[model samples]
Target: MNASSPIGIFDSGIGGLTVAHAVTRLLPNENIIYFGDTAHLPYGDKSSAAIQAYSIKICNVLLQQKCKVILIACNSASAAAYELVKEYVGSKAKVINVIDPVIDYIDHHYRGKTVGLIGTKQTVNSNIYRKKTDALGKDIVLKSLATPLLAPMIEEGFFNNNISESIIYQYLANEELSGIEALILGCTHYPLIKSQIDSFYKENITILDTSEIVAAALKKYLSQSSLLNNLNAYIRHFYVSDYTQSFERSTQIFFGEQIRLEHYPLWE
Candidate 1:
């Protein structure tokens, strides 16, 4: 809750690094402690209770590291665990979820327009994006499709390849996502293949990526709370519940550099 404390961010896997990169760019002086639940990759298929349990453990690890704020960077985790984590953290730390900021963005910018969303099964099943956006009374029409394959594909370093392109085409070609004014890249991993998705529509639709939105939101939150760090104190730390060379590789893909990941095996 102070200016010098590190910001915490966690995701099911390396997808959240996209958010981490954005945060680093936006607040160059602030430190970050990132946790990737590599042990529980593809949280989109897990039960609500399981996701919450994993999220709480990750949040506690961040708290133990003296983080002042926690960002749930995974869409599935945000949908399943945000409220519980918010309540658990209480006043110990501030909590931010990826969904709210994107919903707010749509409410402000795309009102009265049909917006398409593609995400993991848990995210689409939770219906959080649709419910929140619709409740805004902005006359926003939401059409969502569960994109269960993209996350794992991105995690496995399938981006910028023909295998990735074919998968992206299959998902976007679905009739459910057709003819929308905009498409929400509802998973953090989606940004990694943004060009492939963007190529599908040929600039016919606005592709909303939450990495920048969430980063801007964190910057604003820190500024409003008078917790902006002005010193040359930026430090980056990456942790994972489990480790593999693939996770290391994907981390490089997202962050554009190899970060030495410390294994913080939560269940062991």
Candidate 2:
């Protein structure tokens, strides 16, 4: 519960590294402990009960590490397990999810606008963003599409090329996402292919960068709570429940560097 304690972040896979990298860049003095549940990735396809169970387990691991704050960095987990984890963590640590910050941003800036969202099946089907916006009682219209292929494709290192562009274009071209003022990259993995997506729209439509928005929200919370670290040196730890060379190598794509990953299996 102190400023020096590391910030905990977890996702179904390396996609969460995008948020981890943003946090590191924004708060270099603060320590970070990131966990990727590579053993059961693409949580987009898993049941809500299963996502809740896995999220609680991951939070337990982060709590054991004495994390001062825990972030559900995956959209699927945020949609399915945020409330459960917050209740389970209780007073042990602060809990933040990737969805709320973006929602808040939209509420403040895009009221009465038609916004589009593209995410995994789990996130889109959950209708979290739609429900949250509706609760605001604003004139916001949200159109959501389940871009299930994008996340897995990014994890496999398929982006910044013709193959990736074609898929990106195909998804963006869908009638469901048309006529929107902006598009939300609802999945963290989508940021890896953000440039391709950006090129697809040619900057005509705004593409929300969820990681940066979430990072700013984290900074604001720490500053307001007096939990901001002032130290000059800090350590960053990356852990995965299960590991493969591909996951290890893909760290650079998500994290902006070739950081070492420690294998820490939750099932064992």
Candidate 3:
């Protein structure tokens, strides 16, 4: 409710750090508290109920930290648990999701255009992008494919090499994603391999930057709501429900630098 309160951002794992990084770069003065539910990594495979439960638990932790806003930075969690989180956090803090800002951008810029989307199985299967685009009545056609391997690959630091390139190429070459004017990186983790994806496309097609879009949206909301932090000095805290050496190492890749991560097990 106040300008000095930190923004809360949560993902199923390190993938959401992409969004966290973007927010930090865009709004350096705002404090941030990030939670990675590593105990339940890849919400993509979980049922809607499970995602909802984890999201609410994370939201409660963020709210306890007095976060002015809570951002669901994972596409799978956003698709499955956004409404529930929003409703649960009402009056306490604002709740935003990664999907809506991209959808709004598409509505404004890509009307009547064929757009391709790549995400985890849950995000793709949830049909969130297709459904929302259809509701726009804009004649926009959305093609989606589930690239289940990309997140785990990126988390394990497998990108920017031959193995990563081959997998990226194979996914992009899928007929389901062909003939699209733009591709939405539905998963936050996709941005890490964005250069490879651009290389595969030869920069011929537009690759939507979901992190920037979501960050900009957050900025707009904060500005309008009088919650934009103005102080130069700020603090950041990173938490993971479970810890692993790989997750610790991958933080640098997603967050753009080395940062400490505190383990805060929700079930305990």
Q: Which residue pairs in candidate 1 collide? A: none
Scored by CA lDDT, what does every candidate get? Answer: 0.92, 0.94, 0.94
Better of 1 and 3 by lDDT: 3
lDDT of 3 by residue, 1-268 (tens): 8999999999999889999999999999999999999999888889999999999999989999999999999999999999989899999999999999999999999999999999999999999999999999999999999999998888778999999999999999999998999999999999999999999999999999899999999999999999999999999999999988777887987888998999999998
Worst lDDT run of 10 residues, candidate 1, spans 244-253
**Clash pairs for candidate 2:** none
Model 3: what TM-score?
A: 0.99
Number of colliding residue pairs in each model: 0, 0, 0
Candidate 1 displacement at residue 193 in angstroms: 0.5
Of candidate 3, the 10-residue stretch with the lowest lDDT total is 245-254
lDDT digits (tens) for residues 1-268 of candidate 2: 9999999999999899999988999999999999999999989999999999999999999999999999999999999999999999999999999999999999998999999999999999999999999998889999999999999998899888899899989999999998999999999999888888888889899999999999999999999999999999898999999988877988986787888999999878
How well is each residue in 109-150 modelled by candidate 1, as lDDT tens digits?
Answer: 999999999999999999999889879998999999999999
Candidate 2 lDDT at 124 equals 95
